[model samples]
Target: MYISILCFGIFSCQDLNLEPKGMLGGPELFGNEYGVKKYFAAIYNALPIEDFLYYGTNSNNAYRPDNYWEAGKNSLGNMSGEFFNTWVQVDNDGFAYWPYDRIRDINVFIQSFPEYQVNYTAEVYNNLLGEAHFLRAFFYFGLAKRYGGVPIIKEAQDPLAPVETLEVPRNSEYDTWKFIYEDLTFAMENMSTDIDETGRANKYVAAALLSRTMLYAGSIAKYSQYLGFQGEAATSAGMAGIDASKADEFFQYCVDAGKVVETGPYALYTRGYPDKAKNFADLFLDAESSESIFIKSYDITAPGNNRLRHSYDALMCPQPDMSSFVGAESYPPLDFMELYDMPAIVNPDGTPVRFDHRGDIRNGMEPRARGTMYFDGDVLRGKAFDIQRGIYKNFDVLASDADQGSPNAPINNPNNRILGGRGWTTEINGTTLNITGAHGNFEDQGGENNGWGSAFIRKYVDPDRATSDVREYRSDQHWVVFRLGEIYLNTAEALYELGSRDEAFNYIEKIRERAGATITRPALDQSTSNIGTINKANYPYSIEKSLQFIRDERARELYGENHWWWDLRRWRTADQVLNQFRHRVLSSYYVADEGKYIYLDEINRINRSWTASKQCYYEPIPWGEIGKNRNLLPQNPLY
Candidate 1:
């Protein structure tokens, strides 16, 4: 059965006979290689690739929607406790992302492309068919990750068909992932090894997809039972969790797929030599980076296409100095900053360590942390970042005396602490001093356009754009979807889970070597525990200490790349990890008597906390879909 394709006419024609040039019919679209390329472009645009322009409001704005300049404010980083921001919190219920329309478009191509096989050679025909299979698998992956078991719709159904015939039931969770595996396997077997045009999938790209998706599947298989939903309807029916016995099979699949990707012509990016920090920072801005497995390009040249440009720079850097627009919206939290090897901000005696200059905090910090964030005195666009919080008069007590910057602390008296808004000044002993830094910690102002923490997000931010040109919708930096750095991390985790501990750290060392970490290769510890050191989350099931290290490494390497939320969900630890999690900020202060600077840990001004419920592991299927097709009933586990 086939659904009729509609083509609307713009002009009314009574007697005039004319051949329409505006739209192409089925044969004209699928008959030639060029025509098929044009057809595939639309499908590529509708993919579930979450890039810089993704707005997390609802399904309509999920897939790179146009004019979504507010993404930086409400980014996945802010919502998942990766960064501190005032705009969005953890939304337990997802935006109901069902993309059957896009799936139907691909299904039409798969069903109809064979009719034009005579127009092309056998190799070209087979490659195109394999590309279609890869596309279908991508849509299924998006569904399986959100709702555990969605209906498997391979063929396009007719709209006029009987209701009973069209209402397909949901497949089991294991079967849904198996279907994705089959499609990706077909893609790997038939797709060409040669690179396709930029932004298109090749055999290597398909393998990268397989590597990531199967890792998620392997995680679900191993950790779903720990969520304690064993007797629920979805769990009992095998719709929400996979059997624990299948964990090794899925992990092996992930490891094998990663090995295939390594065979391709790709390597970790190392363009800016000698300065490992600069090299790491340049990876995201370099368009021809060798580390990039697949990337989605954005352009500012197109006049009216809002999706072609983003506002990352404008929302990340401060106003009047770095950006001409709204200014910084998200700042790095101290919790994440401590994940890296930072300098000693406090002495062994529990007193705050005073630095000759505030920028001296970067002296012994990890180079990767330096590359990921901008500290005081880090210059960009001809202006140095001055991120001091306030000034402390006379000798200071232990850091605990400040009580995390609480207002009720005795040391926080107005006479002892000098806090002010942006550009504010105060007179002291015949001289005037600026209260807050030029960029942040404005006590009188809110979080909007103010740097709430001591550091700013530098990942994926364009450094070369002139301040005058840094307006909303004027910056165009490509968002990398799959890079070699991430592939290495995926392989390392999968290998460790399969009990190959030594081989896992081999991959971890390579990543740390590029970032110039202090301990490039630490001795492996196989001791098992369920207590997470980062958030102190108590997991229901125990894992090896080396495995937890691999997980933390993923957070450090993939910071601000929009992977934290999904990582927490896939591990079945979101509820425990984010239980009333309050992001902390590092505040810098100038000592009036000692003429030095001190950095102390403090809670954010607003005291915002993010919490995720147990049900956040799996989103409920869209209620509207169940209304139309009752077969979609057993709506996810909790909702």
Candidate 2:
């Protein structure tokens, strides 16, 4: 059932009637294992909503860098406005009440479990208990990540209880993480390694979460080692609490967790359908692959249809007469793509090998270059492109705007100015091309210029689902949280940090092998293309260089599946990546008297607004939360 959005604000009023009062305590459910299982399923269902993979990037909404707060782009009403303000206290409508709700359900389930004495067995009892602990840890982890410290609500709340008495003091971030780790440890020890369903949290799933948690703690501690805690410091939250020593420990934890799966039943989902495409790409797009440790299963017969696919089509579908595909919101900034060094000669190998020259790597992989997207008429997976808008007006709102605003005359009635049309200018085979779409010269019905960012992101769009309205298919696609490949990268990164270049390379090479890509080995011969013949100036040689290299590899390998943003933030490259690309494109667009692009020079001259804002790294804490719980919540400096 579609859970009511009302669940989000259930905590706002003490006398709220929305509480699930009798559901757990009712005689119908209090005495049955079926009731407990169904209740547990509901908790699992709640997970995909806002807790994990909420698509938190507001930039994906209205083609702007930050669209989540815009009243027009979202349905969250005034809460959308709070998105930009750090003082707002709105919790995630889908998630804020989860762990608390689930914890209560679990408590009731455990207490009433004795009623099913006839069916009680050691295996059944152990599984339920294990699931409870794992879920508890999962909920706590979410709290720790969002708020530094949160109350560990272990039991159901009384409906008649006073709100003031119920309110608990905040826990330290350190304590919260420590608690989550310990809880997960218990979960791992008690829970069986197996789960028949796709969505339920399993041992491996818990391990994945631990890897991420450890990574976050380690990275934050490492980065924050030198800086004294204060107001906002970096452009992203990943940069705020970085301590190098902490980072080391986090990486170690991540690697350690990975080892469990490395040598166990869990292996990389490498075996693809021999009937279909035998490529690794097949493994990712195809749902049946064995490598998928956990997935959010969506059945068309029951709560089916992929929301991701639908979102993709809705946002990117092309406008009439535009020739291209659709709205390109969340365009991959140029700076991020530059991280992948372009190979000298294009190799179809899925793996991204090392580049001879770092500078050349930047040049080869520009989104404007054919190497980035179109490789001789086929949509190459490795390359990226500007958002495509169709030529027809019926398909997109932004396209109509562009048609009316045209100087050619007979300006048509533009529907919604911000809705569609026009594309960004990108390079194709080294030649600059204007990939116009809704954002370019589009005039809205209000006669105002309508459009957002110039670049469009094509990563999430399912090529198979492309249609008139881009949102043709709501793909209930399974998002990969952890995989064998990530484990390898984690190990390699941690090893590199530990000053084990040789060992790290071994791990890095394993990843390359899995991707079926070219591997660059240390030069053993003077073959000009070989490592031996290459000039030392052209290649990276140090441990630090290897760390950076592997990280970049991860970027290209996992571009659209939702990992790069976090990686960029962790590497302290968000501003560097985002701003650099913005400048690069702007500069490329504006040409001067001598035919030289002057956009870069102009942007730098106007106001280094983007650059300066890098100091506002982590997203500001919701102001509303702070107002309600002043004792617990703290702002993340300079909203």
Candidate 3:
């Protein structure tokens, strides 16, 4: 009675006649509602949702794949330069993520689910079918973003069929997006609005997916030509880039999807009330927050399932203090910190701004920045973060005198600038004072467990987990897949792109107000520039200054949420943005003579830089898959 399942891996040409060992029969597994849920569980587990457990490496572990303790160190943030780390660099050539096996499963479900209609109510039957479509759209989205025009295999192919019939040609980039749009549209229409299952897709969740995917498609249609790949075979074949004429069509789809989500029972989370920083931080931790549209739940109790638990807390916080395992592998670079409304580190006179306490740097900063990163005095697990770079014995010169912590700077000489490893001290006037703080900037230490930058990522780190329990694979914080805040940003960006500038700012203003930004709304500036101010990236296309501001707001709000890398790719600016992009650090120095603290901008001690080639925009359709099906040629541009 057991059904034989043919396991496939991205169009593998190998034909092996093997026996099915442990198979679940369709009659027993897909005949009823509970059985259908059970059947869908395996498909859900293989989703390409990049969450905390995602490992950004040149392996198969890119999509929600688990490497346990190393996941945090190999996170997309580290690879994307969103969070500075010594371990990982820009994985320019992606990890060849092909999820045809999962796609096949969804296809099977879609084709076979109708047979079970006799066992359920009409609503339940339609809902399950709609859910299947939603899952397929998600898989397609993962593929379309990475490979452009992938082969759209809607029906489950019979392995026993003729080879010619089984081999499907690749679809055009526009058609691929249109297919996803259609699938999501059907899902939104047929899926019930009342289903409350956690982590399961409902009608609103389908709309969120539509909103995200269409936004991506719109961006590609509008910006892909800027990459100048028109002469390439893939571009000419309409496989790698979408036509600019189709931009408005996809943008309008995104706008419509956003409107659909707005009709759902979702709102921006604001439970923490007056303390906007705490409110922003709590939004991620609160599983029941109204802002969360769709979440991928994790459970620490699921011991055997590595994807169910993550090591975020252990690898993000300093060891023996904030974590019980290897401490703090990643730190927030000062380049990103300055994006928020920050207190000036240097005065008009060009000297470092002296502060009464080291924590004064947080005084005028945006609440969202504080919420996203842990500062010097920020407390976690009842212990305050003690982060100081070093002390200046007699610093009485312009901040530039240090020359971005240059070794040849006269003021930076070892005799004057005191720096040390963890717990190292100096004797000044018979009083021994610790040179560096307990948490970081250990001059003699490597970047592995030492804090390289000024702050630690605080967005998804579980504050409630005790230090004793913060070991490898012991943390369980749900990854917010689709949230109302992100939806708002998506809507705003699409609105702006569609020429509805005033309506776009309405959403931006709401997000900034919640983040406690000093300027809730800034006047629009239509001045166009090809070079961005943030990274000074020389983009191929000119963009409005106001548009860049909107993009920056997305970064500020969604920091460490695995969106920056994708954002850069879709904007066709990855290569320019990451061109020898060296991260900067904010070093806290205590002036010995003045007895005050000063924060100075300095290059990361290791001087590590991130670089992405044009090839990064679209990962080459995995060579193996191309070998199996020649139709996947002429591989992605600049492969």
lDDT winner among the candidates? Answer: 3
In model 1, where do residues sit more than 4 Å from their true spots?
Answer: 1-22
Compose the digit string of candidate 1's lDDT tens values, residues 458-575: 8888999999999889889998899988989999999988988889899898888888885554467778899886668898789888888899999888999888889889999899
Q: How well does candidate 2 match the true structure in TM-score terms? A: 0.63
| Regions of model 3 farther than 4 Å from truth | 1-23, 64-66
TM-scores, in order shown? Answer: 0.96, 0.63, 0.96
Q: What global local distance difference test value does model 3 have?
A: 0.87
Model 2 Cα RMSD, 1 decimal: 11.7
Give per-residue CA lDDT, model 2, range 1-639, as digits (tens).
311222223233224554464333333343455755665776675552331124342322221112212221232211212111111222122223224555665554555455655564766666667677777776665555544456666665665788675665455455556666776666666666775666777777777666666665555555433233444433133223533445566677767766655654665555642311134555555566566666665432344222222243343322331113333222233333334443332224422222232123333333322212221113323232222221112222222223222333232233211123244444434755443333432322111122221233333334554344233234444555556667677677666665566777787776666554456644311123201110111221222444556666676565555565455444444444333222212111211112211111111111212221233234444455556656434444344
How high is the CA lDDT of each candidate model? 0.85, 0.43, 0.87
Question: Would you list the clashing residue pairs of candidate 3?
Answer: none
Give a tens-digit lDDT track for model 3, residues 146-230: 8899899988889899887776788999999999999999999999998479999999999999999999999999999888899
